[model samples]
Target: MRDRKIYILLTDTGTVLTRMIRLYTKKNYNHASLSLDSNLEEVYSFGRKRPRNPFIGGFVKEDITNGLLHNAECVIYSCTISQKQYEEIQAFLNEIESHEHSYRYNLLGLFAFMLKKEIRRKNAYFCSEFVATALTKGEIVQLRKPPSFVAPHDFEEVGDFQLEYRGKLASFYHNKNHSYQLSLSS
Candidate 1:
């Protein structure tokens, strides 16, 4: 069986919410998004549904090349997964995307995490929680704690993901005219 790659993007968007999160997590990148492709065409996360409003957030297909993530500093990591795992992830994302309106950002869950508690909402997730849950549901990785308890830094501890790129999100764009390769592995 062949293997496929999935990208995990950890970013610091410098938003008020992210800044607040940083005060607690003390992590450089406070947000996490999962990308199905290296080019980041299929990035999914639970974040600001609108660039101007962080409160009205939910299952969002982020545009890393524009809006909040464009100027953000990020770390990209890639993990190898079996074809079956890829399909499982795709199916899970597709199901949620199909009912995206029902989903909402798990703001309460995010707060509960600070106190070492988990809040299992019906259809909601914070950024890292969403990514962690998706990866777990795909059978790509098993986390020591629940997804709600997972933070951006925990991804590194739990998975065999290789560091791929580290720089401004704008520089990471893959286009015809330009490309950036600040490979940490090299």
Candidate 2:
């Protein structure tokens, strides 16, 4: 834990598309983001580049105050991993972020999940798939299902990750305290 940290940021997003997804899945959240830090300054996910439009998604560096995530309701979980794992995750993220143009949102995978099917597309991922892949690659979690089949709500089922924060993204992002050790309950 000296050299690395990993976090899962699950957001309801409060966008029309996410709201529509919530209605369909009857779940608490519809979007997922992964971060190597607690402040979430480096959050990454596959989602709309522009919040207003549900379309046009790819590898994105996410922020709480930006476009879709502004004031979004979210739950954040923190996990500790070894230095070796951290380096591996960092390398993967570096590659992905540097070549972000090579990736796209997996709309077909999302549809397949809704239909209780599995579809894997190279260089394509949805929000949860991306995060799940990162966590899996980091050896933080052994995902029994394909990353594409993983949903935002699924992360909550695991007991290992610590629920560090829950509430509006703005609350944690803009907290005057500037600490990640907030209360477990909002």
Candidate 3:
């Protein structure tokens, strides 16, 4: 048996960046992240480099709460993956993190998406794009659409994932002592 876990975090960050994405996407959650850990304390995504600026973004280690997303609302989805698959995910993410500075946010790709088009770049990614890529690279999910075309809501459509929690991002921590029926392996 494999001792590996994966989580997808969908958040309505309520930031200017999120609001802008929501305005165009018309979706409840405008940001997406993937975490190797169940607690979602260590999540990865491409997002705003500066808290106040929506334009400049890049690969990032996301926080489910505190800082920019402290007051955000979120839904967490959990999935169990095989050891080999999990290793692939870790390797892919490790590569990205190892040369993170070489990556940037794909603004043109995002704009193309708004127009129902796709414009992929070698070293750039957006929120959902990165998450989709991670899942595909890990072989945890097979996407019908390309990673660049994925939206935050798209993760919700993956039947393999189970909804673990849905509430304010901070509330989960406060209610952690209670039985929430979610677990992750270290």
Which candidate tops lDDT? 1
* Native-to-model Cα distance after best TM-score fit, residue 162 in candidate 1, in Å: 0.3
lDDT tens readout by residue for model 1, 1-186 = 899999999999999988999999998999999988878877899999889988899999998768999899988899999999999999999999999999999999998999898789999999999998899899888788899999998776654898988878877774312663435732
Candidate 3 residues 59-103, lDDT tens each? Answer: 999765577766788888888899998999999999999999999
Angstrom error of the Cα, residue 58, model 3: value is: 0.5
| Candidate 2 minimal-lDDT segment of 10 residues | 176-185
**TM-score of each candidate?**
0.94, 0.93, 0.92
Task: Report the alpha-carbon TM-score of model 3 versus the true structure.
Answer: 0.92
Segments of candidate 2 deviating more than 4 angstroms: 1-3, 176-183
lDDT of each: 0.88, 0.84, 0.85
The model with the greater TM-score, 1 or 2, is 1
Score candidate 2 by lDDT: 0.84
Error of 3 at 151 (Å): 0.4
Candidate 2 residue pairs that clash: none
Off by over 4 Å in 3: 177-186
